[model samples]
Target chain A: MARMLSGRLPDPPAAVRRGPPWAGAFPSTLHDQRVASLLGIALGITFGTCFLTGLVSHFMQHPPNWLSWPSRPVWLYRVTQGLHVTTGLASVPLLLVKLWTVYPRLWERPPVRSVTHALERLTLVPLIAGSIFQLATGIANIAQWYRFHFFFTVTHYWVA
Target chain B: MSGDGDGDTGARADADAPAPAGAGLSVGGFALRVVLVAAGLAALGYGVDGLLTMPRATRPSNAAAWLIGGIVVHDVLLVPATMLAGFTLSRLVRAPYRAVVQGALIVSGAVALMSLPLWRGYGGSVDNPSVNPLPYGRNLAIVLGAVWAGAALLMIGRAVRARRTGPG
Candidate 1:
């Protein structure tokens, strides 16, 4: 009998056999990850600070009138406010950079055996949607000098 | 017919990966980064000058002081205290990370609630005349102090717990 060579091969569905354009195309270096990490760190810190300040500002019943040093009439409320607004403005660039750095990974599906992949897919919605809403509403709030309709205010309040 | 032992298609698959013939990092990123640093420095400078030039009567007076106090209490005191307490509780209960973060956020939300009333322009400014600036400032302070006390207690409680449990 003539030797017909046999290397085991399982038939793949035609759709599976045809790879997407991005298949096997990954950055050869960690440059993207590094960019992402740096951007994430900046964003994380700025957002944390702004959020903390906003939280404190929410509860001020009587504005600070320095009791011991009762002479300084500096516009302290205005100053903290400026900080909050500025920090918020700064988040725009950081968010963009972060999204860009992680863009490539979104396409890569999980290998056959892991729940980690499922969880990532699930959380992606809230993380992205919440982030966008927070940033958008924040910018809008600043534009209006922190003024907004009660509905938007309430929604932003909860989302943030 | 040349029967090559190895079927080596040597054309690199990654040739397209590099920046296109003229493409490079986005100019916008560089421009935006410069603007951010400039704005931050400018704000810091203005804040410092305002703080320094503050009036020094028989009783020292500075609006900048109020802002600074607010900033410090919020960032340094309220946040750290809440975080420490939440962290302690998490360790004690073996709570999930999300729960801890949510707790901290909720505390922050309380502060934001207090700040809202003060934001409504009830307080008059030198530029913008107001009928009730005094009440405005007082109102803000009362809310802030109440929240501060609560946060401080939580912080102290966390410390006591930490001492008893030997620090997580």
Candidate 2:
């Protein structure tokens, strides 16, 4: 049975055996886990601030029947929106460096086929894509470019 | 992968320990996962609802163009420019003052970006006297000047401390 199986099995392709094209391109200095963790926490805080402030602005614009927005502050909207824009802008640099830090892992070959391995890869899709989407929509909305057919407030709020 | 310290060893041991029969997962982990999933679903629902109820006259193509343009302008142009500035600062600034300089640059960049619309008079409206009434260009300049001045003071303070220490 061992001899019969050996004869039927085909050799693995050269590329599959060799691994990814960027397998050897991971930078030695770019693997600082401490920097990555620090930046990740910072980014998370900035994103949370942006999201919360965005919610406030949304509610102010479209208050529900049970909710009443105050007009006494006068500059309330301006401050919150300014904060949202500033935090969103600050996120640009933080996001870039965070991506740079984990970039090497993008090329890492899975050592074993497992559910955990697949889940790890799947989670990255939302992390990267959602970040880009949020930032892009945010900048455009602030610029008041309404290039899309949908309402900017609705899309931005949901995305946030 | 590199086992460097006792903290890592302790963490590994915790991971290897068997889970409790009634509570297999950590509370923090479970809560975080639940919140993340709910947020995702909420966002998806809102997006779908927005799309379905959008005005017929609204043009989606413009929105798509702006979104794509933003990504290109940021990733292709702004990122590289910031990277170049960072590289220049790292090469020119001494180790003792590098962090201060980098901090100043980041603060200035954020302020400048936030001030762009104001500088361009995008938010100025005669209908509302309270909206963007201040002179943004002058305000931005003052803010940036203060940031640099503060950074200079920090550098001086560091130098004084180093001098007092008489060389490590």
Candidate 3:
């Protein structure tokens, strides 16, 4: 009570009362639920696409420098590979946002009951961890620099 | 009296509503979004062009552009746009977010399968290899059919379940 009377509380800034600089950009009517749903969908598609492409590319040979040989044509492998890396890179931001939105659901309830929830939960561990690994490896591959000794190809293949 | 009881409950409920927070779009966020979108578009264009133009003879240029562009587009445009669109659609429809996400993932899978033909060997002879379009086509068909069928089934199940359960 004394603090309030003494004006110790900070005053509201003008920006707060007048509205922010980019106030109207986002639809005013939109709610958090909508945003979360969109994020989930976006992440789902991006991850799925990247995962499938990466898996396919895994079966192909790494070009020019890698030892051994591939049965498929090297050029074809490169293009698909390029696609896989590109899609994965683009998904970074979306993945981050999706994580944010679905965070609430993690605490809200279990995915389902019994085996269904168990299966879904089981996928979550590898899917999340493997996805980060894939993205990191993909970026490293693009930079034309590799440092890991575990053989990224084998790990990537199994994870995907 | 009953009138007094109603008044007390109404006052308590009003107090429970969340106080508005200042999460409306800010200048910095807007600017960031624009930059991201632009960067994505530019990268996509460069990558696609490189893919189309650079020949078997000059391997380095095409490979560089393709790699860089792919990274840019995926990180900036494709992912973000998908997220926003999916979220908005889900909210408007009031559907299960996971199911919607599953639908989107299935579609992306199909697209990836279609582009599989492009993933063959590079840098040797300029000659295009014989691609058996059948496998790719088949894979795409399977992905699409599964996603659509699953989504439809899920929606129907939800409706029936909701009816049986009545309002929560």
lDDT of 2 by residue, B1-168 (tens): 011021122222222223311133466754554455455445544543554466443234554454456556655776558667867887899989988998898788766765566666664357676766788788888999999999999999999998999897
Show pairs that collide, candidate 2: A147-B62, A147-B63, A148-B63, A149-B60
Each candidate's interface RMSD (Å, one decimal) is 23.0, 12.0, 20.9
Span of ten consecutive residues with least summed lDDT in model 2 chain A: A1-10
Output the worst ten-in-a-row residue range by lDDT, candidate 1 chain A: A1-10
Ranking by lDDT: 2, 3, 1
Q: Highest TM-score: which candidate?
A: 2
Q: Candidate 3, DockQ to 2 decimals?
A: 0.04
Interface RMSD, model 1, angstroms: 23.0
TM-scores for candidates 1 onward, in order: 0.37, 0.60, 0.33
lDDT winner among the candidates? 2
Stretches of model 3 off by over 4 angstroms after superposition:
A1-33, A62-75, A109-119, A144-147, B1-168
What is the C-alpha lDDT profile of model 2 across A1-160, one tens digit per residue? 2122123224345555443345644433654566776776787677767777777887888889999988779988888888877888788777767765655554444322233333334444434544665775565455553335556665554333
Instruction: Give the range where candidate 3 chain A is weakest over 10 consecutive residues by summed lDDT.
Output: A1-10
Candidate 3 whole-model C-alpha lDDT, 0 to 1: 0.45
Model 1, B1-168: lDDT tens digits are: 000001000001011123211123246743543344344334334433433444232111322233244434433664456547545665665433344344444544544443444445522345644433445456656765676677666666766776899856
Candidate 3 per-residue lDDT over residues A1-160, each given as its tens digit: 2122222224345544332234543342322556655755565566656655665564444444555455568586677666666767667655555544443333322232233233334434333443444565555544333433334454444334
Candidate 2 DockQ category? incorrect
User: What is candidate 1's fraction of native contacts?
Assistant: 0.00
